[model samples]
Target: MTQQERRRGRDETEEERADRMWGELIQEVRVAQTGVQILFGFLLTVVFQQKYASLSQADQAIYIVTVVLGACTTGALIGPVSLHRLVSGRRVKPQAVRLASRMTFVGLLLLLVTMGSSLLLILRVATNNGYVPYLVTAVILWYLVCWYGLPLWARRKHSSDG
Candidate 1:
């Protein structure tokens, strides 16, 4: 049987489906990777700034966590390219694409955490008020709604309608 015979959905052969799916996944990952890499690079430079020395202990902790999360997000977002490079021509394109999608999802989550923590730290340092956490949480909720919730809902709704 050809690759298409192995697939669980539709009539696409493995190669044809992988080719189509990989292209789409790559496009999605490209957008995510660019954003995370830029954010991660910026986070990496923050610690060397003179202003970093004046941050409170809590703020410092948040900074460290944010940076670490950014790094992880960068790694995950870039993982698909390396994975495809390593597994190319091995007849594992479907598996690689599946794994890459998971990585992208994880990277997005990490990016969210990094952004949320960065916001908390900045707002805390800028305002030094009890409302900092509330504001950060609200922004985080917005991110969740926009990034994940809406997309998932739309997908399900569209698919069901189809």
Candidate 2:
């Protein structure tokens, strides 16, 4: 059967759509949260490293900003858990799912900043090369393409005909 003919309530009832979307959203968050948590955890310990004390003032400033971004990433990623816990029995899964999805997106954005800044600090310290900024910019652009550009492109390319 064609797409329209096989659908009940436009391919799914509200509850069904919510359940499916929530499951998918949770899975995506799990993937994002794990990476962010690991990176954030490592960022948390940087200040204790003996090398951290020797960093230039500029590098230290960069490290601080990176760590802050990492913390934001962690919070946004964990936001969904609190959301689910608070709304579990309230029959508001659909809205919860939407809000969680937005949080996850914000979390991903923060993760990108965390990663880009971390890379910048590392490369600057490790090489002190004049080309580090260019290299970091390239890496950031690559990340933008992979993490955001492709997904957005696909979303626009394959949207439903509604």
Candidate 3:
């Protein structure tokens, strides 16, 4: 096999590979975007709720942080579409795909934090229990294992086989 075939691990050219990667990335981003948007929308309304005024100062701070994280996550997930539109047909799909992938990963991390914080606030308010932090920590750990650990392990295990 030629060097190029070995490098790409496929018969397609760079442009074709970029196209495939871009499509897959966009699909993944679509799912994340929808979720973030919905979460952000809900967050935006929380401030106007009647019970919001009764929340403890600490809970208020947590809510603020969570909302900010959600906003940031929304921006990171949506950034690729803006990036693609601005750079379309510029022969930069490969680079764009790489950057977008990174942004998505960061967005996922932000989403994880936002969800954890949101959960903590809700549980603290609902149950008024001292164990809220521990529960949130456990849930975040589960998220980390599912979202990152398994993927990294599979990547390592499978890539070496090739």
Candidate 4:
């Protein structure tokens, strides 16, 4: 067997593994939930501002899309918690963890899109320069690198190292 396989937590049963995974997932969800909730709260307030009426039709459309994306992101990030609560007594934690993990992944993707859209809208309003799209693109690339590329690269490298 590979060293990695040997080192895997063979001591833990499926229930224990699920418990450990659930703890880790909750920790991760806490961070993301905080961010999305805060962002969504801010987005909610934007429509109430007087300046909201002054936005161009295109900008208004962007704002609407951004708000919806933020709402969806918030929902996805919080879904795991609700799922856990509803299924706490059932003997389905392993399945719950899997489902929660999927929800978290989807939440992160939505968060990424929400952030990108928010940035695009803000930049578009803050600058009339043609470089707004380029700037947004650069920032999105940076987000991708930080959020997915580095972890995936490490996963690949370390998995191969075993």
- In model 4, the runs with Cα more than 4 Å from the true position are 1-6
Worst 10 residues of 2 by lDDT: 1-10
Alpha-carbon local distance difference test for all models: 0.88, 0.90, 0.92, 0.93
Clashing pairs in 2: none
Superposing every Cα of model 2 onto the true structure, what RMSD results?
Answer: 2.2
Q: Put down candidate 2 lDDT per residue, 1-162, tens digits, no spaces.
A: 665564433578888899999888889889988898888888889899999999999999999999999989999999998999999989999999999999998998998888899999999999999999899899989999999899889878756533
Each model's total of backbone clashes: 3, 0, 0, 0
Q: After TM-score superposition, what is the CA distance of residue 85 in candidate 1 from its true location, in Å?
A: 0.4
Off by over 4 Å in 1: 1-11
- Best to worst by TM-score, what's the order? 4, 3, 2, 1
Residue-level lDDT of model 3, residues 75-106, one tens digit each, is: 99999999999999899999999999999999
lDDT of 3: 0.92
How far in Å is the alpha carbon of 161 misplaced in model 4? 0.8
In angstroms, the error of model 1 at 56 is 0.9
Candidate 3 has what TM-score? 0.93
**Off by more than 4 A, model 2:** 1-10, 160-162
In candidate 3, how many clashes are counted? 0
